[model samples]
Target: MAKRFFIKTFGCQMNVNDSEKMAGLLRDMGYEKAQTPEEADIVIVNTCSVRAKPDNKAYSFIGNLKRLKKRRPDLVVAVAGCVPQKEKEQILRFPHVDLVFGTFNFVKLPQLLERVKREGRVVEILNRKIPEEEKLPLVDSYLENPFIAYVTVQRGCNRFCTYCIVPFTRGRERSVAPHLVVEEVKRLAERGVKEVHLLGQNVDFYGYQGTDLADLLYMVSEVEGVERVRFTTSHPAGFSERIARAIRDIPKVCPYVHLPPQSGSNRVLERMNRGYTREEYIEKVQMLREFVPNVALSGDFIVGFPGETEEDFEQTLSLVEECVFDQAFVFEYSPRPFTKAATFKDDVPKEVKNRRLQTLQELVKKQALERNLERVGKVEEVLIEGFSPKGSELYGRTADNKPVAVEGSEELIGKTVEVEITQASPFFLKGKPVTTGVRSKR
Candidate 1:
């Protein structure tokens, strides 16, 4: 009988991709995936430390897992991801945890699990150093959409942003070989995948010497079956003119970008170690707009940071209004253990952070709603993903990556369909399929 293992992922898309790698690794080690915690001999929780709320939730969830282990003494429990890297010793203080692995230590999990079973004791393997050659397993990808997949082209960050722990937890920048990335994209495309999201800590900082992100994008666009390409979390400083030109020229690349600005105030941005000033960021956005006129833009923002005054917060609000993002992921500053910001007094009161967050959320809702409303009556080409969990309707995203719910058949899955926008909301759109075929408007 094969051992059953369960892995729960919590965080950004990068962590979700990590879970897929873990699953593949476990399968190769003779363990089958368990759908639920109760049925598994082993359980892994991939965590996040981006905010206080998520970190607290991870701890509470781990505690709950401990209770489950008490009910079944033979179970192997592991905690992985950003939280483990940040609070290694603190997590070891817990009773039921049998293994604690970190973000950069995934390749050692098979051996660690064996040690836990043989010794009948706790095991930990989290070191904050990128390996000279990190090898990720090629297990079956458990993605929600077969036509869409995320392939991480790079790891870690050199930018030691004050409020961010990624620089410490994930370590310095490491780029995967451009040829390897192209090969992976080619394989995915051959597997009937229509879209691929090239993921990294900061994507625009992709390649150093041989081939840059622009050159890599051009190579990926030439892959046979790949119909669309997208990427995330681009740093403003790295969005060079060469990359902008590549995106404009690549017909397969999606017309969407997620550029995190953190703050609009030059003072706040500098304090956060963002490196790019307000004017530079604005100029980059304007440059993108010049090349890709219909491009949809999204961003990340922090509502309150240490020493953030009313003027600083207002500058953020002003920038938000000026940029008019299609969507924005807003966060309140949380001090991660090893980051520089954590050494400073967390002087911004919780109430003030909460208030600023609320203001930003309201503004974002207004802006998102306005953007969605503008799409009304437009016929957008959407890749049919699958049925929506809420209803019998099929679901997919526009070229701009806006979610659209449509009445579709199972046959439509993996195929592109033209959806006439009938209704639009702040977050998603409701559409009816006009035809079975997808064609470019241009």
Candidate 2:
């Protein structure tokens, strides 16, 4: 019987894309995907180290898998991704973990598995430079709807924000050639993909040898079937007028930007080593709004950093009121291993952090609801993704990335339809289809 493999992925979309790539590699090695970890001959845990919760969750899941390993001693257990990259030899402390690999070690998966089979256990977290000759083969595992895909334009981060571990886990900044990225988009477009979300640790910094993000956006938007182009996790410092202009000029680029400001206090911002001031961030926001007035803006904010005071927290709330963001992700500070912030005293009391987080969340909720309410009775072009979990209604996202649920059939899944907003909720919009024949075009 052919061997079966199961992978549990944690963290962001980048990790999702990585798991898909790993699945493609395993499929090429004659391994079928298992629906459950217990039924598989091999189980892999893709971990995240960005926060303590995900790190603890990874270990908790692995602890449960220990029993499965005992029941099936032949089962090959592997740990990969960010946590392994950071922990390295420490990951081998888990006796049942038969193989461990890192972020850049993905291409060596098959060989590493082979070595494990022969040598009984292995660790392959070496930070070897990826050779220019190595390339990811075109693989198709999206057997279901393939209308949306994630194309990684760059890997790693050089920013080294005091609170972040991505630089250590994912390595230094390296961008894929613009032509290679274009080719990937073209292939996806040929395979019926209508939306391509460019992924990276810091996407706005995308450039290699004079080719910048604006250049790549223009090239990708020009692809024949790609109707929507989106990118994520942009740093405020790298955001420029050129990128803003590209969003305004490129018909296919979505009008949603997820710029993480971290904190609103210039003092806190400087401490975080974010390299941009509160006023500077606001300037970028102003520029984006000037170019695309109706653009939806979302942001991330970290509350209660090491030295954050009540006044600093108020500055964040004040900024939120000033920006009136369409959406926001508010997080309490949690220091991670080796991050510069971890060295400092976690000065904010737990109760204080929780209170501040609650206040910030409540304020963001009001702003988001107000923004959504403004859309009521308006017509929006929604790219139908699929049916809701209960299958009672079809769901999709607008150009600004707002979730909209409409009453429709499964046949409308992959097409873009006009929706008339009838009701608005804090998190999603309820609408009805206005037309059936209209579809998105590049």
Candidate 3:
């Protein structure tokens, strides 16, 4: 009988995509997916260490696995992704975990599993680039969603911002070969994926073989079946106007920008080593708006950093007021392991951090609703993804990167239809199907 396996994924889209790759690897090894962890021959917990809460959750889940391991000694328990990459062999402290590997070593899943099963326990964390000789796995059979796919264009971050652990965990930035990225997009297109969200730790820094992200953007857009292309997690410094121009010009490129300004206070930003000041960041935002007038601007903001003062927090509020972001993710500063900021005294009181977090979130909520409200009475092209969790409504996203829901059946899946925004909330927009096709771009 084929062994059964289940993967529990935690974290960003990158982790989700990684889990899919791992699933594909398992499938190649003749393992079928388990409906639940209780029946699986293998259980892989793909974890995220971006925040401390997920770390606790991952540990709690691992603790539960101990009981299952006792129940089935033959069952393989593994941990992967940022947590294992960060914790290294220390993760094996959980006696139930039979295998531990890092983000850089996922392509060797078949070999790793074989070694663990034969040798009892294994830990592999390569804190460096993938060796040139190691080839990526050709696995596409396990995508979580059928119509929307995440194509990782680049891996890691070169800019070690004081508060970020991405550089330490994911290693330095390396852009995938453009042709390879295009090939992946083509294959996904063949699978009926209409929306491709190019992913990176910092997408703007993508440069491989003398070609930048703009070149890759155009390359992917040229693929026949790709209807909408989007990229994410852009840092302010490397986001050039040329890329902005490409977003304006490319028919398939979506009109959304994720330029995270971690702090609005120049002093705090300098301490964080963000490489751009508040004014410089806002200038880029303005430039993006100029190039793509209908652009959906989204951002990430950190509140209650180590030395952040009330004045510093107020500056962040002012920045939010100025940006009026369509989406704003506000995070309370928690020093992550290996980040430079962790060495600094965490002087911000927990209560103060909570207050600041709430304040910023409320402001962002007001702005997001206001920005989404403006879209009311406008017709948007939406690529229907699938049903929402409730299963009562069909969900999709606009080219501008808005989550839109409308009354429709599953037949609309993968098709770009016109949606008229009728109502808006802080988190989502309700729309009605205005037409049944992609509208011509002006």
Candidate 4:
């Protein structure tokens, strides 16, 4: 039997894309995919440390593999990505962990695995980024969906928002060359990818050799055979008006933005070191709406930051109402190891946090339902992704990124179809296929 490998991933789309790169490298080494860790000759636990819960989950998983390591003895167990990047050699204290690599060290996997087997163990973390020529070649295969793909445009973050660990774990802002990013997109497009999401911790901070994200967007949208383009996790601080213009002008770009304002109170925002006031953040949103009227806006809200008062919580509620987000992700604050916020007193009472979270969530749901309802009578251009979980219907997202369930067949999986909205819910939209030539407003 061919040697097999298993990569268990956690957290964001970036980490999932990182796992794919590792899988492709293993495939080049003649390793096949293993369904379970127990059936694999190598097991990689690709971790995330963006939050306390996922951080702890990675440790728990590595611990459980202790018995498996004892039984297989030959199975090379490695922990890669953020948690390892943050924890470093400390993770190797887990005896069962044969190798530990950081986010930047993935390109060295084939050699690292061999060294781990010949030597006893290995721990490698690169403080500097590897060149694209070294990394992108290994990233060619193992795309989860051939029709839709994620290309990481940049890595790490420059914004040291007190509550975030990205700067420490992933290191500072490092952008792939714009030409390199475009080349990767062209390669994916050649292999039949229709849509691409440019991934980064803060895509707005993508600066390389005098080029910015807006420039990169124009480049990627020009790629031959590319149908849809999207980028995510933008910071409100430097979300330039030029970016707003690019979104407005670029027809191939998708009409959605995920900008996380973190909190709505200027006081809370300052304490979080977000750099932008509530007013400034809203101004950016206004600019986006001015450019793309039907553009969908989604955001992140931290309800119970340290020292967040009832008034501050209420301010967040007000922002949610004013922004009328297409979607919102509400998180109760949990301090991580390296964040400066962890040094402050986590003074918000647990019950108060829970109550505030529930309140904020209810408001978000109401806003989502209201926005989705507005689309009930509209026709949307949707990229048919695949069948629903039960395979009873087709599922896809509209140009504005609203989920739509249309009664269709497997044949429509990769086709872009027009759907007239029939019903709306807080989470998704229900619609049926329409044969009209109506263009999507978004």
The estimated TM-scores of all candidates read 0.95, 0.96, 0.96, 0.95
Query: Model-by-model lDDT, in order?
Result: 0.83, 0.87, 0.86, 0.87
Cα-lDDT of candidate 4: 0.87
lDDT of 3: 0.86
Model 2 worst lDDT run, 10 consecutive residues: 131-140
Model 2: per-residue Cα lDDT over 145-242, one tens digit each: 46788888888899989999999988888888988888888888888887889998899999888999999999999899888999997999999899
lDDT of 3 by residue, 18-72 (tens): 8887887899889998989998999999999988878778888988999999999
- lDDT by residue (1-442, candidate 4, tens digit) is 7999999999999998888888888998899989999999999999999988888899899999999999989998999999988877668789989999988888889999989878888988888866563245433348766678888888888889999999988888888988888888888888778789999899999999999999999999999878789998799987999999999999999889999988999999999999999999889999899998888899998878999999998898888888888888888899988899999999998899899989988988998898888889887888888887777888888877888998777767777788889999998998888853233434
Q: How far is 267's C-alpha from truth in model 1 (Å)?
A: 1.5
What is residue 246's positional error in candidate 4, in angstroms?
Answer: 0.7
Give lDDT tens digits, candidate 1, residues 1-442: 8999898888888887788778878888888878899989999989988778778888888989877988899998899988878778878888888888888877777888888878865556556564422255442245546688888888889988888888767877878887778877777777778889998898889885778888888988889888888987799999888888887888888889998888989998888899989888889989999999888889999877888889999988888888878888888888777788888777889899999999988898899999899889998899888889885889888988899998777888788888899998888999988898564532
Q: Flag clash pairs in model 1.
A: none
TM-score of 2: 0.96
- Could you give the candidate ranking by lDDT, starting with the highest? 2, 4, 3, 1
lDDT (Cα, 0-100) at 330 in candidate 1: 87
